[model samples]
Target: MSSPVLKPAAELASTNRTRHPNESADYRRARQALLVEEIELRRQIERVAELRRALPEGGEVTKAYVFEGERGQAAFAELFGDRQTLVVYSYMFGAQREQPCPMCTSFMSTWEAKLPDIEQRVAFAFVARSPIARLIAAKKARGWTRHKIYSDTAGDYTRDYVSAVDADMPGYSVFTKRGGRIRHFWSGEMGMDTADPGQDPRGAPDMDPLWTILDTTPEGRGNDWYPKLGY
Candidate 1:
């Protein structure tokens, strides 16, 4: 079925702008052009989301994965609770690392205040290779209260969904339960292997708000600096 027609982005941009008094005609023209592109970008994001939601039924999750969680030992399906959809994030803490990954920590810090709102729509949790106690300590150090966490103690879930060979990397995955059966819905696949030339690997529609905020500034996200767990 065809989607409804929409107004052209350029028309929308041109019709709704309020100008800065100091701006010149040349600046106005450039700003108007950029606004048009911004409108188009917003539309493209919606289109991509539609495509993602329209994907065919994903593979069934038959493996019996378990984790050490707040409720002690819980099976994979238990993570969903009453919600049909579950969003799991792989945290970059492992038995071999002295500290959790700063980049992952930074990404997660933004999620602190947003977790309550997010959980209203879908079940959410963080899974890591570190023992549950260590992960809880890290969360306490960060001063977060609402994050649901789990340890992939056997690494079975991480190996199948996040990495092979049990690499300490972050992953985003969604699963859905329907008619008493759970299935993998989606997981981010972009990474270093698929990085574009002259750019560090990152997910499109970047999930990290820090980079999103930095991108709006004149300096942008520079090459040298990265977030650290401590100052």
Candidate 2:
């Protein structure tokens, strides 16, 4: 199906109805230019999403990975339950660390409230290298009731999907189940090597809203600041 032809971004922006009392003409002119760019940015975002959806089938998941969670031991496929799609978040809460990575925790805190909305379309799970009890304690501390966390006891899944050596880091991976086969779908690949100058490595359309909110502010996610477990 073809989409209806739309007016050019500049044309649409020029028709913007926003008006602030006592606004200067110079400000209005600059805001109109910014609106045109914002319209183009929206189109670029949709274009990238279309490209992602058109990707070829990803590799099949063959390993018989096992994980232990609150309910007990469950095989990899069991994580999906009934959903055809699964979303997994690998957090930085390995055995070496007494506490979870503050950034990962921050991301999870944002997601904690969003799982219900997300799960309507995909199964979601949180995985870590720490024992199930530790993960549960952290969840309790964070007051998360719905984030289903699992422990990668043998590190098999972590080694393959998260890190080659099972290094403690954060990750987001998606898997799909269909025709009795599960295959890796997508995951954030951008990292330190992919980072732009004077910026931290981050995913396209970053998964954390904290950064998104910060990006709109004048301070603009200052390089020296990071979220601590506490103030």
Candidate 3:
């Protein structure tokens, strides 16, 4: 089946013309500037993706880590199931924290909605530093029963992927497997940033497409927004 269609903002703008007169020239200019910056940013990101695709594969990982699934006790390989590629999001939910990271929760909410489409290309799993029991409880509380959840309580896998560093480092990493060999494809700590820590003090730019799309709206992602447990 074809991938789900995502309508671009420009297309929508062209088709729908209903601009408010009170919208000042300055406001229009700023909005146009933002749209131009977004287009250039997308081109630059695509270039970076090309470079990443050309790089040599990273090291392998086969350590056995435990996880809690719909069927109870599950292993790392079992989480991967039959898929060739596995994309793991290292969620920042330590064993002591009362709740999972809110930002991470937001991203997972989007992922949960697209689980079926994601499963078509590669398998997806959420790995947290919290214990299996804690992870399961959080999942149940969030009502995320369809997507897979796992625990990296020992910090072995999270450390390997560089997703867990001290208590603040949060990121995403993708890996692929063939036979007994596993190779890292891509690892991005900066979700919407331009550079890493030392390169720029500002710390990478936030270029998440979801945020960009939301920026085009009137409320602009809104102030009091949180992912609900259910739709």
Candidate 4:
């Protein structure tokens, strides 16, 4: 009349399943080594974050540069337009480049969709080291009319923010303002770590939640992804 006792998982293991003896010991050792390496990499990332948090306050802003905006043109101070902080993403699209950088294009595609929410928290804009007319023309061709765009043709602003190295290197930077003085805060020169090869030189920090959400789907953001302007 007593209830049957439950067996342990080990006892339920299938005895009939065949085991391959051809698997080399070196292969098993290599797999374990990779696992150990991954753990160490994660620790290194945490250390980098600690150092970032300890960084001292940056230099004060001294110069204002001109940039073209959605409503014609504006200056660096005007772009902030009264906001306490500004997040400028230095897009790689330029007058000389025939096509937009795929990695930057992907990030912008994600950022554009959440512009309304981002605008409420901080002033956001995209800057490029290209002529205003060129930037405008590219924006229209790509259909990114809603998101604010700007041109850093002279490279002064880009160099000041460390977003541009000379006339070739491309990057992004963020700034904060206090008592009428602006200071550099952060930046994203590298694309996301998971980004495809031949896209961007920098790797993106794992902060955005959009990637995780997209990972749940079967197609997984699909391989042939490309940014569509209006559609």
| C-alpha TM-scores of all predictions | 0.97, 0.97, 0.69, 0.62
* Per-residue C-alpha lDDT of model 2 across residues 3-122, encoded as one tens digit per residue: 678789999998899989999999999989999998998888888888888788999999999999999999999999889999999999999999999999998999777888998889
Considering TM-score, where higher is better, how would the candidates rank from best to worst?
1, 2, 3, 4
Error of 2 at 41 (Å): 1.0
Model 2 residue 54 distance off true place after TM-score fit, in angstroms? 1.1
lDDT against the true structure, each candidate? 0.93, 0.93, 0.69, 0.67
Q: Is candidate 1 or 2 superior in lDDT?
A: 1
Clash count, predicted structure 1: 0
On lDDT, the stronger of 2 and 3 is: 2
lDDT of 3 at 230: 43
What ranges in model 3 sit over 4 Å off?
A: 1-36, 68-70, 163-169, 191-210, 217-231
lDDT of prediction 2? 0.93
Looking at model 1, residue 76 earns an lDDT score of 92
Q: Runs in model 1 with CA error above 4 Å? A: none
> Cα RMSD to native, each candidate?
1.1, 1.1, 6.6, 10.9
- Model 4's alpha-carbon lDDT is 0.67
Candidate 1 per-residue lDDT over residues 41-69, each given as its tens digit: 99998998999999999999999999999
- The residue ranges of model 2 lying beyond 4 angstroms of the native Cα positions read none
